[model samples]
Target: LLGRFFEARAKGRASQAITRLLELGAKQARLLRQGTQVMVDPLELVPGDTVIILPGEKIPADGVIDAGATSIDQSMLTGESHAVDRGPGDEVYAGTVNQQGRLEVKVTGVGPNTALARIARLVEEAQATKAPVQGLADRISAVFVPVVIVISLGVLATWWIATGDFADSLSNAVAVLIIACPCALGLATPTAIMVGSGRGAELGVLFKGADVFERAKEIDTVVFDKTGTLTRGAMTLTGLDSEADERLFLARVASLEAGSEHPVGKAVALGAEERDIELAPVAGFQAWRGLGATGIVDGVEVAAGRARFMADRGLHIPDRYLEALETFERRGHTAFLAGWGGEVRGTLAVADTMRESAPAAVAELRRIGIETAMITGDSRQTAEVIAAQAGIATVLAEVLPEGKATELARLDAAGRSVAFVGDGINDAPALAAADLGMAVGSGTDVAKEAGDVVLMSGDPMSAVVALRLARATFRTIKENLFWAFAYNTAAIPLAALGFLDPMIAAGAMAISSLSVVTNSLRLRRFH
Candidate 1:
């Protein structure tokens, strides 16, 4: 009964941690039916149903906004402290709180299909899985039981032959068996893995299996994908130069790009709108495949695209504008030259911004003695610029999607245990090939499936935190194992020598298991 009580307590502690995450979902949902709001259970929500979420209310299902807009606090799911703006056609997940404004969301997923449910399932699976060290413990326990039985038999025979007393010999043999039950050995690695993995979930890190804790602690070098991992994936206007009227030049360029669907063109158009500049109507708009786009704006021919595109259109770029283009390109920005009536008038520099936590994340890794490197398909100049901004020393430039795994192999050949951090479909191979793979939460599903650890926060600093947590968890596992082995090695002989009563032996065995469990519970206090 005492043994069962300790086992139940250890299991209950792990279950409670998982329950906290599962309880984040809102119990009820407000649905819109024929223009009327109806209260319904979250589980009753189905696809195609429009749900109404007001301020200070939790979103009850994963869906797209059908009407209205609001700022949503996604800290519960993504660990981002700030509220993100959600408008028409924006995706919202269950468990996120609506900050302000009314939103009508078209429910796309609910119940087990929701993102929150998937996260809880992953945590449960990780806790249920066993670590590699547990297999060793199992083997030892298997051998230990029989060896202890033999010792107990020997004690019984020696006592009975020396004193001609069977009852006393039997009592000593039973005491030896009771004390050397190997309960502590059985509880050591698994309890630590359960508590450690549960703690990881609370920190926005999800370990795919118990074995990930072992692999993560062995990482000495961390390789990062440049785009969408260390840097924001979206392009933004960073620098603009014009020899003519700045607003007029921007209006003409933005007018020409307003018809395009390319990322750079959208950034240029958005920049003009943010400044409240009015764009003239464009006519005869033509886009060249690899070059820039040109159109007639307000009776003048305006073009916005690459330098080659400007030169192809017989436009002359002044020395000052050319120098500005070089300055922007050298700093990893993609420069667009805008020309009107055969003369280049302005230059636009667009680039992906680095994450706020990237520099500090790299510094933290270095401070902990882990080397950091960056790999990307970008040009050497562009890759180097971003690497320097993130404080990473080694840069692998112009690496194709297929070649990323090869670069990881090269690192492995150099005796480095590498962990790859990536957030795109192209990174799936590299993620799987590394010693440990960390996938950003905002990344593609394929990348997350390949990763051993998922960074739900999507912050570079979370990767550092994941590594620290893994190391701490593994350390706890080792400590538990050591104590279990030491306790058994010291206590078995005392029982065999008749120095311990059977009742005392049983109590000691139960305490040994409880101690291992209590040691693992300390991980719940980890930051």
Candidate 2:
């Protein structure tokens, strides 16, 4: 009975963490009905309902803001430390607090469809699953139970023949059986896993399964995807030079790029918009994958992309333009050349800022004796610069999107256990190929699904936290198992030798299980 109590207590503590997260859903929602506010249960909300959120109220459901603006505190959900500004057309998740301004949010998701609910479900499922170490304990316990019974029968017979006292012999046999109950062995691995994973969730890390804890501890090399993983993934136009009228050159390039869905193209278009440069309509816009784009901009033929694209188009590149391209590349900025009417007209440089946490994350990984590498589709000079900035020594530059998985395979072949961190649809393959895949929370659904661990904080430093937590959790499991095995080994013989009374042996068995539970609960204090 005492053993069962300890198990129940451990389970209760683990569930408490998850319960607190699920409670984020507001009980009542203030909805805008016919321009008047009506209070209703959050479950009654549906898509397209306009919910009014005032200062300090929890957002009732996931939705887009229809009117008004406010600073939303998402620290509880995403673990971001600062509140973010949200205005019309921006997304506000359910359970986040609205500060200062009133927001009219059009509901897009409700009930179980909310991000908070999904996170709770994921954590619950991970806890319910068993780790490989738990399976080993179960197998050992299965073999141990019958062997202990046989030994108990042997002790009963030996004592009866020697002393010829049935009552004394029975007590000794019963004591052996009581002390070798296997309760501690059963609770050892699972309790620790439950607490560790629960603590991980609070730190903005989510393990997809109990088994991921085992796999993560074995990772020796961590490969990070460059764009969204290390850098902010937002591009800015840093420099623009032109031989023709600067505004006209930018207008032409930005107009052709406006049709592109690429990040670089979007950056160019946004630069034009920020400068209030009116874009001319383009006819026959064609995008050459990984090279450049071409179109007829305001009746003039315009080609904008890499210098290689210019060379391919039979366009003349001036010496000054070549010098500018080299300077931009040397400075770790992506440079693009623009030309029209068979002559290179201008050059543009775009750069992405590195995340503030990236360097610290690399340093932490190194401190823990793990190797770090970076993989990117950028040019060699660009990748090297970014890698150096993050203090990463190994760089796999110019790797195509399809080649990421192959690069990870090479690391695996070299006997290195690799964990890949990424946040894009293109990274899904690599995320699956690594020994352990960690997906940033802000990544695409496909990438998250393929990853074994999801970093809900979307901070590179969280990856380091995940790894350290895994090692700590696994170490606790080992400790619990050792204590359970050692306690059984030492106590069984003492009970069989008539050195312990049956009541004393039962008390010892309960203490052994309680010790394991207490040890596992220590993980709750883990940071």
The most accurate candidate by TM-score is 2
Candidate of highest lDDT: 2
Candidate 1 displacement at residue 352 in angstroms: 2.3
What tens digits encode model 1's per-residue C-alpha lDDT throughout 1-113? 66556666776797676686578888899989998999999999899999999899999999999888899988777656888898999989888899999999999989888
lDDT of each: 0.86, 0.88
Displacement of the residue 401 alpha carbon in candidate 2, Å: 1.3
For residues 1-527, could you state the per-residue lDDT of candidate 2 as single tens digits?
66667877887797677788778768889999998999999999999999999999999898999999999988777767789899999988888899879899999989888877777778878888999999899999999999999999999999999999999999999999999999999898878888988888788788889999999999999999988789888898999878799898899999999999877899999999999999989899998766789999999989998787799899999989988987887888888899899999988988998999999999999999999999987778878888999999999987767789999999999999999999735578999999999988751131236689998767899899999999999999999999999999999999989999899998899889989988988888887
| TM-score to native of every candidate shown | 0.84, 0.93
**Distance from true location, Cα of 225 in model 2, Å:** 1.5
- Give per-residue lDDT, candidate 2, residue 108: 91
